[model samples]
Target: MSTQQPENTAPADRKVILVTGASSGIGAAIAARLVTEGHLVVAGARRTDRLRELATSTTEEAARSGGALEPVRLDVTDRADVAAFVQGARDRHGRVDVLINNAGVMPLSRLDSLLVDEWDRMIDVNVRGLLHGIAAALPVFTAQGSGHLVTVASIGAHEVVPTAAVYCGTKYAAWAITEGLRQEVDPSIRVTTISPGVVDSELAHTITEAGAAEAMRSYRAHAMGPDAIAAAVSYALAQPADIDVNEIVVRPARQR
Candidate 1:
C-alpha cells in the first residue's frame, strides 16, 4: 500500500470563523476585526443588505490584510436556517474553526409595562438563538476534534437591574448555557462567553417602554463603542488552542 501525504497545504495562519448577527454593532465589529487579522469570516444576519455592505467594505481591507469576509442570511432562532448557515460555511471553507454566537436583542421594560412581546423576543433571540448556534456547530467541532464557541452575552448576565429583568434573565441563561457546554464538550473544544457593559449599538433603539427608554438614555450616556467588545473577542480568539479563555467582561471606565 502506498502512503499518501495530506493534500491540502494552505498556510495554517488563518482560521475559518463564523459570526452571527453581523449586520451591525459588536457582531459587525468582530467580523471586521477578524477579517482584518487574516481570518476568513463568514458573517450572517437577518439584514442581508447590511451583510453585503459589510462584505463590500471588507473586500478592500482584505487586499491589505490577506483575509476576507463572506455574507449569509441567517436568523439564529430558526433551527434549519442556522444549520444551513453552518453547513454552507463548511461547504465553502472546508471546516468551521470557530462559531461566534453574537446575535442578541435587548428591549428593556419594567414589570409593570408588561411588554410581553418584547420579553418573548428576548428569550427567542438571546436564549434560543444561542442554543441554535451551539446545536449547529457542536457536531462539527466534535468531528474535527478542535473548535471554539464564542458567546456574546452582556453584563446583564451578571446582575439584574430595574426595567431589565426579562433581558437579564435571558443573558443569565446564556452565561449558564455556555458554561454548561464548556463542561460537557471535549477538552479540545473551547467555549468562551463575553459579557459587555453598555456599548453604543442599535440594541438601545429597540427599546419602546417609556420609563426604560428614558433610563437607557442616561445609562448609555457614556457607553463604550462596539469596537471595544470586538477587541476582547480578538484577544480570546488569538490565544493558543491549549489556553481557553473562559470568560471576558468588558465595560467602560466611567460606567459604574
Candidate 2:
C-alpha cells in the first residue's frame, strides 16, 4: 500500500534473477550482465561441468562487481529437474524476483523430411520447457507479490521461412503462450518476451539438416553478438516496475 524505497541491503536486496541455458550464448551473457549490474544471478544449464565453470567465473565477476551468482544444473525438458532447480534456487537465494526462460532447441528441416524426432525435440525443449519454467516460478511469484518472466523466442515466430516450419511453430507458440501468461497473471508479475533475429550463437549447430545448417551458418556469420540481446534484456529489467516492458525484438541492423 505504500510506495516505499526498500533499502538496498546486502546482496539479498538485489533481485534474485534466474536464467536458464546460461552456460553459453545469450543466457550466459545476460547472467553476466545482470551480475555486473549488482543483481544476484542464478545460472542454470543442463551441463553441471559448465555450470561449475560458470560459477567460478560468476564468483570472480561478483567479487569485482560486489554481487553474487549461484549456478545450478538444470534440464528444462525434465519436469522433475525444473521443479528441483526452482526449489533449490529459491532455497539458496531466499526469493526469486525474475526468471529468464532461455533454453530452446532449433533443429530445422523441411516438413517433407518429416523430421519427427527433431520436431519432438524442439517442442519438448522449447515449448514444454518454457511451460516448466512457468510452473516452477508462478507460485513463488504469487507469494512474493512481485516477479518477472523473461522469455527468449525468435523473429521467425512472427514470420515464416523455408525449412523452418516446426521451429517457427514452437517459437510462435512461445510468443503466444507468454502473452497469454502475461494477460492472466496479476499485475504484480511482469512478463516479457524477447524475439531475436540471427544473433550469433550455437543454435544452428543443433540443426540436423545439412543444407539447413549450412544456410543458418551463413546467416550466423553476419548475426549480432549475444551482448546486443543482453543489453536489451537489461534495459527491460531496469525499467520502473509499473512499466511492464512486455516484448522486445532484438535483431541485427542488417538482419531485415
Q: TM-scores of all models? A: 0.95, 0.93
lDDT of 1 by residue, 145-202 (tens): 9999999999999999999999999999999999999999998999999999999999
| Candidate 2 C-alpha lDDT tens digits along 121-218 | 99999999999999999999999999999999999889988889999999999999999999999999999999999977778878888888877877
Question: Where does model 1 exceed 4 Å of error?
Answer: 1-11
Least well predicted 10-residue stretch by lDDT in candidate 2: 5-14
Against the true structure, candidate 1 has what lDDT? 0.93
